[model samples]
Target: MPKVFGFAGYSGVGKTTLIEQLIPRLIHSGVRVSVIKHAHHDFDIDRPGKDSYRHREAGAHEVLITANRRWVLMHELNGEPEPSLEAQIQRLSPCDLVIVEGFKRSDIPKIEIWREANGKPMLYPEDKNIVAVACDVEIDCDGLPWLPLNNPDRIAQFILNTFVHD
Candidate 1:
């Protein structure tokens, strides 16, 4: 099984930015990484009038678009219950690690991204699965492992040491 870790935080926090930085650094270090980001609202990769969009709109449950560079498979739930995180992870191709963004309530090891300016309470206090935190400002962590939000390399190293390496 691929090692899984997550980043969870309130909106306006720099979770995406941190992940973006970590991906390149991990890749450069020769680690195979894949990311799964959760969308809180409706999102569409296909544009209007495109054949894939038209097919989906016409009630196709799944659409596959293949090109020279890549391929995308879009599956429509059509009111079905959203798939569980475990189920979603099972569908991914093999990799060394899977970095999940969001799904805050899931029972997976996670690093909570925090920004004091967001005025949000710390999630680590409430979620036992939260193993560490990354923040822009030094805040009381209640003894949780902490990393600087500005240093993606160090953050990446922390992740690799904690989860990817034995």
Candidate 2:
């Protein structure tokens, strides 16, 4: 398996935005990046009337949809316990890096995104797995490195420097 790294933050802290901008930079550097984002509530990639949706609604446990450009596989948990992060990662095709957006409590190394406007409590203070902090305004990062949240190139470079050492 490729190395797994993550971004941990509260909702609305720009974790998604950061990752979206950072992915291309990593790819531009010739690194293939895969992302696994954890959602807190029920989410669906298929619409209600789609064939994939119909198959899943018809009690199919798995549905595979393919197009000329891409393919997707949807698996129904069917009341089973949610799989661990590692299990989900294992299902992804091989890549140079895995940028996880949630699974905050997992022990995988992560960069904590923070913003003063969010008013949410800081997570890195308690999360030993957090390797760095990316914040909007100046703050005392103490021992941890503080990355520029607005500058994705620098953030991408930092990620490459710290975690992409293959």
Candidate 3:
């Protein structure tokens, strides 16, 4: 099975930024990576007036747009409960690793991204699945792995060393 890792943090703590930086490094290193990001608010990938958008607006349960280079499958819940993380992961194509952002309550191993200026309490103390922390300032983590938030290359290397194996 492909290895799975996650990043969890309160809003504006640079979780997305870290992931953005890590992707290129991982790709450059020849590691195939996939990401699953959870959005709390409603988001739309298809814009209004587009065929796919019209199809979905017309009550299509799912709409798939295909092209030579890429394809996207949009599933409409229509009040259905969101699928579990495991179910979502099963939908992805094979890859070297799956990096999940958010889904903090899930049991998968995660690295918590923290920023003191975010004015939010740390999540690692409460979430046992968190295996490491990337932060802007030094923290008293009781020996948990600490990664510098400013250095994406180091962070990428750490992730590769910890999760990816030849």
Candidate 4:
């Protein structure tokens, strides 16, 4: 099983930006990483009336669209409850690490991105699962390691060092 860590924070707190930057660094560091992003609202990757969407809409439990270089899979479960985080991780192919962008309430380890401009409370100040914080403005970060929010390479390295070993 791969180690799972989440980049968690409120909206506009740079979670996506940090993950976008960290992923390539992790890849350069020779770590195979898979990402799972949790979306609150409904989303459609295959547009309406598209072949793939039509296939799925017509009761295909799993529809996979393959291109020369990549593939997209949409699995639909009707009345089957959402799988657990562990189960979801298992469905993905093996990787050195798994970086989840949301699912903040799960018990998995996480790095919280906090931007002062967002005016959100510190996730770690309460959530014990938050291992560290990446922040914009420096404050007394208590005992947790606080990294500058701008440098994704450093944060990426920290994540690999703390969670994954090569």
Candidate 5:
């Protein structure tokens, strides 16, 4: 399995945007990256009119949709308990790293994304898994390293350095 790192933050703090910026940088650095994002609400990648959607709505437990360039696999829990992070990791093809978004309380090493304007309390105070803070403004990280949120290159390098040592 790939090494796992995570991004944890409250809603609308740019967790998704930071991950978007970081993925390409990591890929450029030659680290194969996969992402597992936890959604707190019901969500779907397929629509009602699509064939894959029809298959799923008809009681299929899994449906894989493919085109020439890419493919995606959608699985229905169908009342099964949600799997743990490790179980989800096992489903991904081997890569150098897996950048998980959400699962804020998971034990994996994570960078807590923060924005001062968001008016949210810092998570590092409670989440020991948070290894660093990525924020729009400098703040006390309680001795954990403070990372500049705007510099994807620096953040990407930190991730690389941390990954190698771990």
Candidate 6:
């Protein structure tokens, strides 16, 4: 199975920024990485008036937009049901790592990004899945590994060393 890690935190806590930084580092280390981001809103990947959007509105279950070097398969579900993280991972095919940006309540392990200025709570002290914290605060981590908040490369290396290597 491909290795999995999550970047989770309260809204506006810089979780996305941290993930953005980590991706390049992981790639440079020769790990093929995929990401599954959870959203709380009704998101749309196909824009209106576009051919892909029209095809989906015409009852297409899946639409593939292909180019010379890229392809995107957009699947339309009939209802709003959250797929299991494992199921999502399966959809990504073979990869060295899958870094998820949500599913905080799920069983998957995570790196909690906490910004002290954001006034958000620490996910580590309560969630056992939170294996490490990337934070700007100096609060006691209760012995959990703490990576500097602004250093994405270091956090990525830490993840590779701890989880991906051995």
- Which digits, one per residue and each the tens of the lDDT, describe model 5 over residues 26-54? 89888999999999998887888989989
Higher-scoring candidate on lDDT, 5 or 6: 5
Worst 10 residues of 5 by lDDT: 157-166
Predictions: Cα RMSD each: 0.9, 0.9, 1.2, 1.3, 1.1, 1.2
Candidate 2 residue lDDT tens string, 1-166: 7889999999999999999999999999989999999989999998999888999999999999989999999999999999999999999999999999999999899999999999999998899999899999867877998998999989999999998963
lDDT of 1 at 109: 97
Q: Candidate 1's C-alpha lDDT?
A: 0.93
Model 1, residue 158: distance off in Å is 0.3
Better of 1 and 3 by TM-score: 1
Clashes of each: 0, 0, 0, 0, 0, 0
The C-alpha local distance difference test score for the whole of candidate 2 amounts to 0.92
**Candidate 2 backbone overlaps, count:** 0
Cα-based TM-score, every candidate: 0.97, 0.97, 0.95, 0.95, 0.96, 0.95
Model 4 per-residue lDDT at 50: 94
Candidate 3 on 9-86: residue-level lDDT in tens? 988888898899999999999999999999988888889999999999999999988999999999999999999999
